[model samples]
Target: MATDELPDRIAEIFNGSTIFITGASGFVGKALIEKLLRLTNLRKIYLLLREKKGKAPVDRMQDIFNNVLYDKIKSLKPHALSKCTAIQGDVSQINLGISQEDREKLKNEVDFIFHSAATTRFDDTLKYAVIMNTRGTMYMLRLAEECKKLKLFVHVSTAYAFPREKILYEKAYEPIADPQQVLSSLNWIKDEAMQEMQDKILGDIPNAYTFSKSLAEALVYEKAGKIPVIIGRPAVASFKLTSSEFINHELATEHVRPSPFAMMDCRLPVFVTFCLLRYPQLKCLSLCLRMHIEIY
Candidate 1:
């Protein structure tokens, strides 16, 4: 579609809007940033990035855009890259470890927020997972409450957060434990003690990832007072590699395994639809999962 022929409704909603995104370097976050730049007339995108391996946030941001994922934007709309700015921060830290100037700027100018940063490792320690997923959500919610122009706060959660339910619904489920109490315990409980009680704390949730995500959802339900919130529960998302040549070469020596459950295509449309649409009554959005015969 021609730029002039872009849909008016989407354009009207996003034109000149300023967005703040955590986990901008992750799979979903990168895809969402690409879509916003390629499809919307948004004015700015602030990415929260932390230093790693001696590289500054700006350097990491450059590395992300250099990936093959941003090739289309580079050729078609290179100027869009200029709108993205990296703010130094870590979600696991208090105040997100963001500078006061940057925090104030976000509070004054940001219109939308996408909190997608979390430790996704299934084997991660319960303490680290809670700090990253549960308490990190609390900090984001507090910041969302202070945003002067905030219109929406989208929290990216997992479909399997409540795994005990055979059929998951598009609504919040009771967390395994109170999020506040969980956070408090982390302060006094030793790592060995937490590890010993892991089975009891997780119950049937499976791992730290899902268990922390469940608590995050509960925290959002309890604290998101007046703020417009949407909890997106996306199920096992993966890319379907269509190029035969790339696949053959890439898999020549690699072992590929089939995903146990149905997968959802991790595409721009999935994120864009839920993030940009102004549906006040739509509190929870769950992506429909479909079976894919191809093994990755």
Candidate 2:
């Protein structure tokens, strides 16, 4: 019998490490949790979940496991999931809205931190965007700095964070605005005025989310000294996800939306996924989700 090779990147980082993750409920976040549980023997995954809809964080974590994403893991390493614990907190609040005890615990015990919690809403107001994307980053940075044995702080940003440049490369640039200054100005700038000036403020950037992400990138880049920080910009594109395609093992590589490309299949015999990292001459940035698919 032959077996597919495990993704070494997953094991090299997550194996036997206590990971503190912020966005466990998001699409990418859930997939990450599944991959970690499936591919490696991790120590623990601390999900920073806030009590919402009158439900506890642990209860919500259970609902997350209920998703089909965890089906295989639920069967294979049934006890592997026992490593995951819920840390009640919100990213949009002070100190990620975590209790002092939990914060100190993470600072002491956690080895890896993944911050994927951000509002990707294009139409969100500048006020809210700054708080969620920009300020939320600062809060995570503060916590990352305090970790005694933190190895890496992986921040999930967007390729569109720098929309001004057509040929975007991997490098940190000067921030549009100081995050601290943006936080202070949020106190005084009325939402109405902010809306009016939003276009001018973002300049070539399209939405408030990207603009705030650009600012967040700068904040993360500056703190590279305290911790080994990586700003992961996923140019993940949306597919024409038809109902039938979702069930059957079929993939369409049609140039959907002229930018991002996503291929879907029922299963992958061997997970060999390749990413299309080319954005030649288009204003539309693509989000590529390379998934393992079985050819029927």
Candidate 3:
């Protein structure tokens, strides 16, 4: 469908549903929230946020809402504020770090879940990547399993999960190694030692990002048979074009890639990931994911 038709179509899907969004502060997350508010009569949107540099989630959300792109949405829906609910938590924790009461509330009220939280830094350490990208996914899955009324669970993976693969495909691939195993074995190792062992663990994988992300995909497959699950994979450089010289750079997993795409855990799935979530029952959503992976 054309971009102009997407909002109206999406609006129809989420007419009265409540949604829980992770990575709501990131670029795509912000866009997703804006589009929903601008186009749909979404009942509520719960944002999963972690306290950052002493800033609160409400403050952070306000900053995003005050952005210029949201102006149309704000004006179109004067009560847009009522649709946004900020839930303080980290995706890396159990139950997304939400309190027991909040977890119960979400399980009861939320109809959709969008797992877009991931660290997108190229040089991120193995420990950090595994925790946020791999384990964080595990946590989200667990949370979704607990939700009594979940319609769909959308996990943002990457298209470059195989950073070294030149020509990719639409099908999903399994990880060379188990993510949890790698994480567990590295638990006792020192940071420096872990860094040094990165090559050994990754084998032919290009970086820790793709390696862990591959494992995250495996996690979804492992869990999907139990619920309705779909994965989306978006090719590299799906967003605004930079300069020509930077075009290839933006197309690959290189410098200038946003944090959301830079890190592992997120795969490059397709846009349909959101559609499955619109199904209105407990379902698993994954998109092979998207990012800019360069080819020589």
Candidate 4:
């Protein structure tokens, strides 16, 4: 559907807006691209893609669109994908490894950015995780700063970033460590040494993934400055909608919806959670075990 044909608020807001997205090959990125193509008539969608294995970035992007996730968009708007252009880049590298030509084009054309590139593996080495998640975020922020027409920068974070907190709020909480200090440590600390000290470094955080993400959030808080930014912390994203039979059977007998607090336990397989919260300046969407909490 065209943006003009859709009278919804979201479609109107995004109409004619040019967007740049990192992690365009990931699950969340693919889903976001599909939705924008299907629901909104955005002018352009620039995808930051890094070559992996033996394939090139453009080939990887083609494979991403070939997935079943985009089947709906293909049927709805066959030409919608023409708006998407793949930019060769690696988020873990300096300046996101984007060429000067591409960088200049992005700065001039992009109106919004979604920085969703990061390693989500729990077992990632501390050094690798910091370089990818924490430092990568800092680099993306610098790029955002250069975009003269940029309106909003959305940082995709994880809900488990602050595992120590009992009630995770929408606002930015203190990070586990100073991101810059941690990044600097990587220069002197070898990968093996970093691995040995991983547990000690993680402290309350369960894994390097969450720990690095926490530090990335802190970096954003410190460096966002005048940039219009919003942080979204989403929990485990299960692509398959298959429900646990045990949860269904138990809930059927009780005849009541699960409590929102059930999510805190992290034991239940299925439940809906609700919490009253307010984030005046920041917008966040927390999706945990089917629980959706949106604070704006």
The pairs that clash in candidate 1 are none
Local distance difference test, each candidate: 0.79, 0.72, 0.70, 0.74
Steric clash count of candidate 4: 0
Which candidate number maximizes TM-score?
A: 1
Model 3 Cα displacement at 112 (Å)? 0.9
lDDT of 4 at 33: 79
Candidate 4 per-residue C-alpha lDDT over 1-296 given as tens digits, one digit per residue, 9 for 90 to 100:
98667566555556898999998876567667776777778999999998899899889988888865566578889999889999999988887899999999999998878888899987888888999999899999888989999877777788888888987876778888888899899889888888898889887678889899999898777655567666767675543222365346437866676432221211111111011012324433333333232110
lDDT of candidate 2 over 216-277, digit per residue (tens): 98888877665666666667533334445433533354443321122222111111111111
Sort all candidates by TM-score, best to worst.
1, 4, 2, 3
Q: What RMSD value applies to candidate 2? A: 7.6
Best by lDDT: 1
Clash count per candidate: 0, 7, 50, 0
Off by over 4 Å in 2: 1-10, 237-296
lDDT of 2 at 205: 71
Output the better candidate (1/4) by TM-score: 1
TM-score of each: 0.86, 0.79, 0.79, 0.80
RMSD of every candidate to native, in Å, equals 4.4, 7.6, 7.1, 8.8
Tens digits of lDDT, candidate 3, 1-296: 88765555545767798988899887567767876776668899999988888989888888777765566656778888678988989977755688888888888998777787888776788777888888888888888888887766777778777666576665556676877787676568888998888888777777777777777777776777675566665555444433354455455764555333222222132246446644635354444434542211
